[model samples]
Target chain A: MNTNTQTTRLYHTALSPYCRKVRLVLAEKKIEVELVEERYWEGPPDLKRRNPAGKLPVLRFRGNLLAESQAIVEYLDEAVPAPSLMPQQPLERHEVRRLCAWFDDKFQAEVTRPILNERVWKKITRSGYPDSRIVKDGLRAIKEHMDYLAGLLETRRWLAGNTLSLADFTAAAHFSCLDYISDVDWDRSEALRDWYATIKSRPAFRSVLADQVPGIHPAAHYAELDFG
Target chain B: MNTNTQTTRLYHTALSPYCRKVRLVLAEKKIEVELVEERYWEGPPDLKRRNPAGKLPVLRFRGNLLAESQAIVEYLDEAVPAPSLMPQQPLERHEVRRLCAWFDDKFQAEVTRPILNERVWKKITRSGYPDSRIVKDGLRAIKEHMDYLAGLLETRRWLAGNTLSLADFTAAAHFSCLDYISDVDWDRSEALRDWYATIKSRPAFRSVLADQVPGIHPAAHYAELDFG
Candidate 1:
């Protein structure tokens, strides 16, 4: 067996919510990870070898290449078991995973992906100029999402429940991305804004907030804890 | 508090892979469910109340409405441990989840959704004629997916490991939908075909196999045990 330890590395893009989610969880668990930024859009040859899906946020941990953000974070929660990001009961856990999916799948397709594609990725990749119409639609969709989240926050301490969980990190990851581009109208919902502010203040969020992508500048309030 | 028992119910569509996944897991756990077919595309007003995301495969279990197919199934696995679909080890469990994401997110986007929308949904909703180019692209994508799955089944007894897992069911769920539409070219991969045959023979697959969407007929070999 190869006894020498390999460093825990993550192949990711800085702006990706999926990568941000994994990065936040890793930092929360206090696991040291070497973040190697991969320009996945260029279709890096080795990415396919590492993950058949050729997706961003592929983690190299404990001599294994782990793909899929939700899977990786859930595994981290299960393996490390410190400051657990998952709830104890099955029902609670279901709530956590449901919200995680809500942000990653639904929220992403509606708000994050479209906005980022038009605002950030297009500029970064030198693909095309930003389309105002697409960005407008994304902005419009986010308000409904904000209202829904505010309703949830009124009843619970965190996105999933009374306890902090992966759902919070997942939501923050998406919001942080949009916030970076100054797309979020924080004034729409106080509860949603407060929830973002609390999660943003965490030590786990430091690396994510510190991110600087060349050619596109983060919004002035993107890294502020009290911005809301 | 009222103590009368409530029936486990699922609001779903007949041809959705997400719904099939939940149905398979429920049946596998021997949990009788009332499958209420929801015409989600028509923008059912109650869908928003059931799930703010307004998606299908919403499960009403234990008096609570549960959404997201993966979350519902994972909760089922945890709540009812008998004949557990998830492995005990954290790494193994991660593998199961990774594959589930692979099928649900990646494969569904590349293969299932595009093909189904073109061939099935367009016809059912009276939206438009089938787009052969899109259908062709989806069919082409499935071959690559089959190759990947065939590679995994080369050594392992199941997709994730040596035992039946949520990964297998998740994959079968997507494949069965494609199979129903006669989109999958099963002869491309022997191992993959054998894997599907074995999983299809399970009692859990009965409900999914019986699914019939009006106006769109299932392929002749869709429900056959010895299809390969």
Candidate 2:
């Protein structure tokens, strides 16, 4: 670890998959960080100052303000070499990044964001009621995504390859959010269920599992190790 | 370059910034790739086969089917190291990736996609008539983005830093798309305009400059070296 006197802090929202991805990577690398929940929807005045993108999961580390979850995690991996979250080969590294995009770009748009926007964020922000149609669409999309993951898991131990990489944490971060709302169907695929259970049991996952968003209770089995 | 008997090919749409970004990187790296236009919006059957996410800019390189624009470009930079598109330092690299995300995720969502959807895509797909309000909103958004880029250029040589990087290509890709539809107000920022002109004059930009989408015309100054 590149030890700096400045305390590493993460500004994030509890249910955001992007924020959770950074938290998971930070924890997996065993870096101690102080977490500050940012109500980004409320649009804090300093939010844009922290990140020009005006998004959450901004990290204050080593005298640098890092934004964008993927960039931050990749920088973390490069800066902290031990317990590498990336594969050595360029081709293998591409696979890890491809899956990260799958979860962050595609899955987040299709499943996580839509579902959470309706289920969690709407309530937190005191916005309109949950749109059942949007929630249903997101629910429908998850099955196909689950099927795809199950097929990938049939061969590789981890999402990207045999070794657990950033892809696993990225995928798990999104799944954990959905799981928190009891939206995941654990019985969809035994392989995926096992994969989640394995990742969920890791020490790095402890902090995320302990997360509880105010005004919205976590699913009963969200933190259970053997629930599935 | 890792030579393989298999011919390198890129399945892409002409006006897609994501595809253009990959094309720019490929050209910048001096890699020869045969371009094949894929009408992804129509949902070609093999689109999903090439990329599970059903996205454009899938590259067949070194006999591997690669998806995701950022992943493909990063892999290219790593695989073919000469004339590197990435900075050596971790912090510098983070800046590049952060800006790439800014253009791809934020700018695309706020400015490029909406403007193109209303102006170009609707005409190409015959989906609906142009919505002036959406186009107006996108045009308005680009001003703030231009101001931000001009601010960066005031202190830095490139969008990310001193040397040209993937961030420059990514930002250029989006700007070019908007420039195609005459949506960009290059006069708004002198530094930004100079940066674009400098990048536009590169030999690597030739293929992108030559792009012609059916029934849609490029702006009079779009392909010009001294556009501003």
Which residue segments of model 2 deviate by more than 4 Å?
A1-5, B1-5
Candidate 1 segments exceeding 4 Å error: A1-5, B1-5
Q: TM for chain B in all models?
A: 0.97, 0.97
Candidate 2 chain B minimal-lDDT segment of 10 residues: B1-10
Candidate 1 at B145: error in angstroms?
0.4
List of chain A TM-scores, every candidate: 0.97, 0.97
- Over the stretch A1-228, how does candidate 2's per-residue lDDT look in tens digits? 434649898999899999999999999999999998988888999999999889999999888999999999999999998899999999999999999999999999999999999999889889889999999999999999999999999999999999999999999999999999999998999999999999999999999999988888999999999986
Across B7-46, the per-residue lDDT of candidate 2 in tens digits comes to: 8999999999999999999999899998889998899999
Instruction: Give one digit per residue, the lDDT tens place, for model 1 in B1-228.
Output: 233347788899998999999999999999998878889989999998999889998998889899999999999999988789999999999999999999999999999999999999999999999999999999889889999999999999999999999999999999999999888898998899999999999999998888888888999999999986
Cα deviation in Å at residue B146, candidate 2? 0.6
Query: What are the per-residue Cα lDDT tens digits for candidate 1 across A47-133?
Result: 999999989889989988899999999999999999899999999999999999999999999999999999999988889999999
Query: Every model's Cα RMSD, please?
Result: 2.2, 2.5
Residue pairs with backbone overlap in model 1: none
TM-score of each: 0.97, 0.98
Using DockQ as the measure, the top candidate is 1
* CA shift of A177, model 2, Å: 0.4
Clash totals for all models, in order? 0, 0
